[model samples]
Target: MSTPTKVPLGSLPLPLSSHTLTKNLTPDRTAASPKAFRQVQHSQPSTQRRARLLSPETHFSYVAPNPLPFPFKIVPEEGEDVSPANQAELIERWLAAREALQEKDITERSNGLRLHFPAGREQPRELIGLSETGLRDCLPHLDVGDAFDLLGLPRLTKDPTNEEPQETENPARRELIDILSGYATLINVEEDVDKSWAPWSLRYSGHQFGTWAGQLGDGRAISILATPHPSNAELTYELQLKGAGRTPFSRGADGLAVVRSSIREFLCAEAMHALGIPTTRSLSLISLPELPVLRERIERACVLTRVAPSFIRIGSFESLNPPESMFFLGGGQQEKDLEALRILGKWVGRRVLKLEGIKWREEGQAGDAWGRQLVLESARRNAKMVAGWQAYGFMHGVINTDNVSIMGLTIDYGPYAFMDVFNPYHICNHSDGEGRYSYQAQPSVVMYALRSLLTSLSPLIGAENALGNKAVSPGWAKDMSDEQFAEWRKQGNDLVLAELEDTFQDTCAEEYRRLMHKRLGLRRIDLDDESKLIRPLTSLLAEHRLDFHSTFRRLAYFKPSLVDSPASTGNLESSKADFDAFVESLMALTPEPQMVDTFKAKIDWKKWLEKYSERIESEKGLWDADEDVDLQRERAMRDANPRFVLRQWVLEEVIKKVEQDTKSGRRVLGKVLQMACSPFEPWGAEDNLSPTDILDDEVLEERRYCGIGEQQMLGFQCSCSS
Candidate 1:
């Protein structure tokens, strides 16, 4: 091992404002929070012998880059001048240049062991296997600096506006690419050259619609290592490869992901993170020109490495409670699996979630109190997550128990959608014919997954162990007397089933209402207005099938600046007149030229406006005498609405534009990431893109360049291929 070196824990040389650089250094800290980034609730525990970000460097290994699979190098008719170039020769030269890099990260191409699940602990072997080989010519599409902020590393000094990477202007940007692309590029961080970390795979099981499918784990993803978050030593984050290669869990499929799916996840993950939703953050996207994968047709494969505090999932625990088909793993030997489940429960609930002492459990006969707490907290967060989805009109097509993250972030974004016309019944995934995971049914699906998880914990907690309406294994308390087993089940049911039911329902209701209030620009008030204001407005929109996103975006621009401010606080007449003009403008608003089925003359637009305006007027009575109710309402709306969303058509346009031209595609993807990453960048007290559909407006003219809104993407179809 190289002699241990002491790097300052307090600070490092980073190309970021002190405010942005150390924003996350302090554990559970809200110091200098960036407006663009949300303060993630989960953080590493401070393991500070001192404050230093250590790099766990491994030995250098070189393998020739793979050539792009044949069909992707689309050729013109025979004798055409166009010919595919050699990828291997180019990759060799690239590797030669980066050979000097010997940083601990070994060139951040994401090779890390999971947070070291103890050996002999019986982790699902299928989930922890060798990473598929043949990592070839990595073409960097985009790297997000905000994601690196979690590490508190030297930032790339991000500017979403630039469609092209300005690697020349900022050396840190180049450094970020090097580290994330698995090149030996070190900016200003500490390293450990002696110790090399191994990669880990995880196993999980999920219900297709409500039935358990056994041994479904991280089929194509492998976690190489987990270390303390750079800024906050308290929390640890695992960087893992998605679409990297195959694992033992690959079943019959090739463990690969195409560039299109990779880009979707890359942008959407960042978009969700920026929107303040708890999600796994993406670091970098690398595409291999020649790798091929079968989707609807042949496509090039790519890899995306994402960061998360912990990748533990409901399925992680559920796998220990395997499906009936795999009952041999548990069956009469169930206690062994139970013990393993408890160990994992404690690790995730205590080490990761920090739920300890009484917060984790009650003093009783329970063997794993953390199991119950994990389920409860998962339910609470998932409840809010669903609420966020509904408020933002996001339809998560698949909420399979396996896809449902224990961390409560949206995982596995296959065939998801953002509803345009407020159809609570909309199904985003074309494969989900029964609407089992539709917009309105998300809560039930989320609840079903939680219940499955809760039931899986029965073995750990000594309760009735039944899932999928059929027992996966024999009951955990089978040895107990009938009375004891019955009592244990009753108490456990009341604690988990009854208690979680109430909490989930109550929390989801209040939180959904809270989100809707913000979307509609309503000021704080104790009065329940589901029937009064919200429902009526929703009814109006639904009746006419008005565009959900555009309607809300336009609502944000409706506030007359002069009248809503504190200056006009007591002047009721002037406020009313200005508000009337705003209402009139909204009533006379025109739909985008492409709207064949949107809000129309048939709906009582003026009547709905009169009701909405009167409701705003009613808020005056609730505010303190000096408070500007209208202004508060507008501010809330501004924060809630986003001008740009990752509409399906937009993504398709990006794929088409970039495939024909890499340089041009990279530029377009950069612009898309910028808008998706900074959804709030366009609107303010200054430029107003409202009074018309943002698609037709010039607020961010480039957003219109994608040619998406000209074709409504509300019901665009995406299948399970992703």
Candidate 2:
């Protein structure tokens, strides 16, 4: 309940020159911010920025030769009558092809997971039917920021672009809503004029736990449109309708997403984006009251349209080179599969990674050397991404290789949670019985994924050696004996893995240190800072079961200048009292109120404050000489420590309230989204967006749903059944 006021000290010891601090913060004045510290700006909503309106009649132009450049199966022609009987016939033929490829000897099956080869790499076909016609009546909840900035649509209520009659008026707005609702389609012709774009799902495989989970792909997700970035010409946006319908990779279960999970995915993606974490963006949430999807219970179905650079993942590569245990289902299509891997790798390198010319192919480097660069770049990006997750106390419950994005953006929001209490070993997914993807294990798990990616890329890496410099040849394996080919693959993977592992570890550790430094209001971090300050802070919070976000936020109020003042200055006792107040503030948000005094007595505040104060004093010169140093440091720390996170408890309340009353719940969702979009600012602080809603008093007020939950709700976990 108490807040610490700033205390001033004339000078501090070991202060570096202002020049030195300037260099440290901005080493190259002309260059951009370090990639490790970069934050996404599109997540924020601004009235001044406007984009072109998206409509069903508008052609979704794709920068790629083909929006989806993979082999696919043929289905009922657009005009053909796909009656139940005719559909059954089509399915039978598809099954026969699958049986021929699978050879019928492989009996191993769970969730009907099996390899599905396309009839041929020819015409693109519609994989599945859309949701029932009843969905057209529902309206979608669109993120104003995403609509305005990404899709070039005006906000219905509060955007300046509302003055534009066409954007604000009926048919255009209705058309946008229909496309998002999955009732209407966008025109497909783009740069690849000859290619017919259709709704398609990707096929891939990955490790579920630690073992290989064969043939896991997009079950409920369907890619429908690919459009150029509204602002950036070089960038292309691929929008996918998650929970759209079924595809070949749906396996046995019905491909549907429940309302609870869809809401979570929609909110968290924007929330993470607001937090400056690299992640996919949500365009809209279309609720289907007419259709109920059975998960653990019968819940209303919802379709979430998510936007990303590309949905390719580490598993995309792995799917091509399945384990030999798959009975070599790609046996007949081995060369074709290899070619697919090569093409996929090159596309990622050129488009996603943006490597090119000398950067893409160094002089005399193997033609496929970009493969290794792709792996390292992916490692670097992921290392920074996971480090951001760790610093913010986020645990992505299901980090299967399939969920790991090649672009290092956070994908698949299933069973994910932000830390309530600072428990290092907290498992957010109840289904994760082994705690394999726990908060503490995330970095190591990422390393596992990178290695899996490297293994998948081994054939491409070994192409030159296996083909005797004819790297473009797909049947490189045919030239060598099976043993020789295996040896070459192993050697290449080992070499690449050795280098990749080092890059990942070193990058992750460095990025983690940088983020931790920013979070703690420190401009400089020594080698011992982790042991003395960072790890100790973690231990102290876990020991007290203290709230993670609030603890760091409260520390911003503690004045480093006043800590350990000299007796001669007559401020020593007050300084010690001030530091005690800061410690009490940490216990202020603790769920175990009765244990607060006990925690205070147990923690070595004297020792911890000494180290923290000293570290702060060392970096004192980092502030501008003319500015107030404490205020500068406090602002930096507050920016790094968001006042609000899309906590699991908050999400639960929002979901419940929405089910109770649709209109009011929609308002609540928008209010929370506004809060999430500008997390660093307090709930009522202006960010040039929407005004504060009265619902904040009922929803975010203390003890209503504000602080971390108590009891079982604390560190809440969920089943992946959603």
Most accurate candidate by TM-score? 2
lDDT of 2 by residue, 430-505 (tens): 9999999999999999889999898877766765445443344434344556676577678668668888998998
Top candidate on lDDT is 2
TM-score of 2: 0.74
| 699: Cα error in model 2, Å | 9.5
lDDT of 2 at 630: 83
Number of clashing pairs, model 1? Answer: 24
| Residue 574 lDDT (model 2) | 76
Task: Please report, in order, the local distance difference test score of every candidate based on alpha carbons.
Answer: 0.53, 0.60
RMSD of 2: 16.3
Q: Each model's TM-score, in the order given?
A: 0.67, 0.74
Candidate 1 lDDT for residue 317: 72
